[model samples]
Target: MLSTMRSGVRRHSALLLFILGAVLLTPLSQAQQLQTKFGCNMTRDEDGEKVIYGDTGEFKLDGERIEALRWESALYRPTHGFECSIDTSDDPQAEVEQDGDKSNWRITLKDPVAARHQRGYDFYNHGMNCSIRLQRDGDKLHVIPSCPALCGSRGNFTELSVDLKTGECSYK
Candidate 1:
């Protein structure tokens, strides 16, 4: 009887440790995999009469047609740690083309880590000393800038929203 009781206790303790380890690591691992799934472009419609946003830059939505670009922006997945490259056929002359190689890149998220709008939103090392908020609207996601002027206009705080299905962003 004594031996059986000791073994049972040992098993229970091991199981508890395993559960705790998983619970603690789950969030960290999931956080690293979160990324923005959609990007939008700014466009000018009807020759400065109106504008429609696209993935790259400003253009006439009606008078001029611009191709829409889409890409999945995932967190820096440590598992692969694969490098990234840029294709600028859309705008080869754009300044963004300068960073054709992924040798040097940086991304930041706000502090106090507000809840993510989607299952894949992650809190990474952002070099800022203010709170961050993410807003979502349909298939668009907007990053609420932490600039003093922006916050001041928005009651001194970052606001966030999310599209349940598309993980799009929009500012409120």
Candidate 2:
């Protein structure tokens, strides 16, 4: 009878430990699911010109640290078609920082892109100082690119705002 009681106690203790472990881990699993994923493609008419823009990426978190991030953006217009396109998939220098509910991404190109000089007379290597900044708030992502090398004198990659849920975007 004593051996039976001891075996019952051991089984109960094991069950209790399993329940406690699951309860403690529930919040962590929920937090991990809060990671953000965003993708969008949009085009609109602005002053009789067709403007196209899009972006796709995901930001994953491990505990309080960003474990992985990949992002890409593109913009096109009739006036300056293919203004800017950036892919940070293989860029080891890409970095993201989070503050409160907002996140900021800074990306620099590893190779120079060819572009026409500001004079429009000669070709020059652009993207040497190319830098892109992306800011995310709620379901919106804002793209601010300072890549003169990617866009020559004939075109520019103006600031853009994108809606992650609806895939609607507009120049800002």
Among all windows of 10 consecutive residues in model 2, the one with the lowest summed lDDT is 112-121
lDDT of 2 at 165: 77
Q: Estimate each model's TM-score.
A: 0.30, 0.48
Q: Which candidate's TM-score is highest?
A: 2
Give Cα-based local distance difference scores for all models: 0.31, 0.59
Question: For residues 5-82, could you state the per-residue lDDT of candidate 1 as single tens digits?
Answer: 999999999999999999986754433222333444333344345433222211111111212222211212223321
What TM-score does candidate 1 reach? 0.30
Cα misplacement distance, residue 52 of candidate 2 (Å): 7.6
The TM-score obtained by model 2 is: 0.48
lDDT of 2 by residue, 1-52 (tens): 9999999999999999999999987764543332456666778887898877
Candidate 2: C-alpha RMSD to true structure equals 7.9
